[model samples]
Target: MKKQLGNNYYNIISEDLDGEIYDLLLTDVNAALFDYSDHHKSNKLPLKSKFKQFLINRLFVGFYLLNKLKKRYTGEMIILSNAYIPLNVPNSVTLLPPWIFSPKKKSFANWKIILIINQLKFILKERSIKLLLSENFKFLVDKFELELGNLFVKFKLSAVVVPNDMAFFEKLALRVAKKKDIPSFVCLHGLPARYNDIDDNRADYLIVWGKGIKELYIDAGVKEDKILTFKHPVYSSFSALELQSNLSNVLVLSRATCGIPCESSQLILTDRSTTLHYTELVKENLKKLGVNKATLRLHPSENEDFYLKNLPDDFFTIDRSSKDDALNQCSLVIGPTSTMVLDAIKMGKNYILFDPVFNGLTLEGMPLVSPFTGESFIKLSNSLEEMKYNINNPNDNISYHELNNFLSIDSNDEEKFLGIMNKNK
Candidate 1:
């Protein structure tokens, strides 16, 4: 579709799509949304006492609601609760109200009946609360789309750019863009990993970080023309950092408890326990290799208090610094399957893959499929003993040239992204 605004400009809409390329767009709209709290910090509590933790989570929710009410009544919040327009934004861009909830819209009785039936399916399940909230949020997002459609018509939006197509709002925005006859693209936020039953049919195009992700999407049945390769705007800045000489510290990146889907509930519990268990085992192996100076970097969604209280007191120090700093300081990095590994590769740092869930398992039964080809550059350790050997005898086989074949780590990220945006215009 051609530019409807009579200029080569785009309207970027997302909650977390902020950065250089997004900043380049003169017209942008953002939704102020809160992240869903991970209330079940089960890793910190005993298996039998998790029910009590759930009750504590309920109390936390009550307090959170009260805080929201205070923000609403006091006019301290913006977007949903309070009304305010940002002065820093350019006049061309239009920021919409927060799409959290619609108090004016009444709940449909038929929708409530459907939600109740869905809740009944998970009545006795452990993640029932998550299911209930997700269902209700989807209903609200549908209403939010109606409001957005009107805004798109009034503003004469040319195109829509989103961070990803995973969330309810992102998908809804894509639908609105389609109905209005505008191009919609979802930019790559992180390294794309293979998962079962993922739907990638929401957006008109996918903006990926490199050729590696492009190939992965193609393998997942996405059209080749719909996938575009562009260097990550943020990480491209790290290409200038010089590798330090004293790269001896080991950094262990921890994954979230419910990061992946399992075949059954038994597998879910086993996956969580085994991940935590193997992480501790990695620490012990590092100590045996005389690498006492190490750090454990928790996922943003992970509860730090849970790990600090539950894990061994003196096993490894927790590093809350930025990921780039941690990767630069650490000589060797290890993790199960994360985008951090790609960051390390881009920075010329050595890394080892230690996914206990799928390292030894067959491809058919693996919990998660790796995106990389697992070439000799990226070493794998099946057991603690193997991990120790890899740590002690480090290899310098992986080079930037080899990684470039997979990831397009070029410096002209801004130019490349704009080229794609203006292609249709």
Candidate 2:
């Protein structure tokens, strides 16, 4: 049977260390709201307004095409106006008919129609300017915050547990929780891109993956007491997987970008363009080592179609399978500074840390200095040849004890999480 927190606010999803029921006001970054509205579906907009909407959409598409053209030939467009043009209308406005703006059904009339049309014109103009300035998303952030605040009030939520406090919505939710005198907690899902990303003001409590992360937060100015070390729930199942000795099938994890560095002196950071470059290097090295079978696991944020089109088909198989399945099948896992490396460790797979940008450089302000310094289990490879050698000579140097220092593999993660929630309550 399901448990209840109060009348209708939240429900008791799980139990604590003392077998006590804990209420969770579950929430998420509502991504579905950002998806395009179904144009074919019937809506409250009048027939005339619908036609105007169609025209607006067409105009938006035309402007987008023009913008693409402008990007291609910036110098040649001397005759045309260089004013910014948005690629598309905001999903929030386009998803619904303008008639929906009417607070009362009877209030919808000519004035409302005029107002809606004017609003659309204004939005189009503003969006164009925002696009030009690369500030399109900044405008919507306020709307997201307002919506989140309203939801919290409507549900009479007691507390909020989010994955990352650094996210715009999560931070907003945390602020709302603070305003309401309710506790807010952020579970560290992955490593922060930079030290500055960790904001002490964002959450009341932080449930970290392990001691390593706890140390990172403390160093970033987050109070030591506010942070709690808990084993990552995802790693718990894979912790039982024994490390393979004879490494054969290799899995190369691809990242979308090497996040901005904390220090100015950190080697010139590379972008997504380096993805193919790194993958090709890995492919060449694998081929040289006589390891024909290898899979390239694209990051979740990466475009699968783009990689498939660009990457050599014969060199490596593009793995779109679940991470657990991929980890299970592969004997060796290789990647840069990614949370998946921790996952690979939990799965008892040998992983090689490869990052050309951070080579021979260390940032004192960052949690991951060189990726090589933190844990001895991770084999740091400077070049393709080095990586190939490491793979061929499969080292059994990294033990579970070393892995434990980074991640709490054997701990009851649920209990630890519950303890944090209970303590805050």
Model 2, global lDDT? 0.49
- Give the clashing residue pairs of candidate 1, or none: 247-331
Q: Write the per-residue lDDT of candidate 2 for residues 349-421, one digit (tens) a residue.
A: 7777765544443222233442354345456675766676665554543445555666553255446545533
Q: Which 10-residue window of candidate 1 scores lowest in summed lDDT?
A: 25-34
Name every residue pair that clashes in candidate 2.
none
Estimate candidate 2's RMSD in Å.
Answer: 18.4
Which sections of candidate 2 miss by over 4 Å? 1-156, 197-201, 236-242, 245-247, 258-270, 358-376, 383-389, 392-397, 409-425
The estimated TM-scores of all candidates read: 0.60, 0.57
State the displacement of the C-alpha of residue 246, model 1, in Å, after optimal TM-score superposition. Answer: 7.5
lDDT of each: 0.50, 0.49
Candidate 1 yields a Cα-based lDDT of 0.50
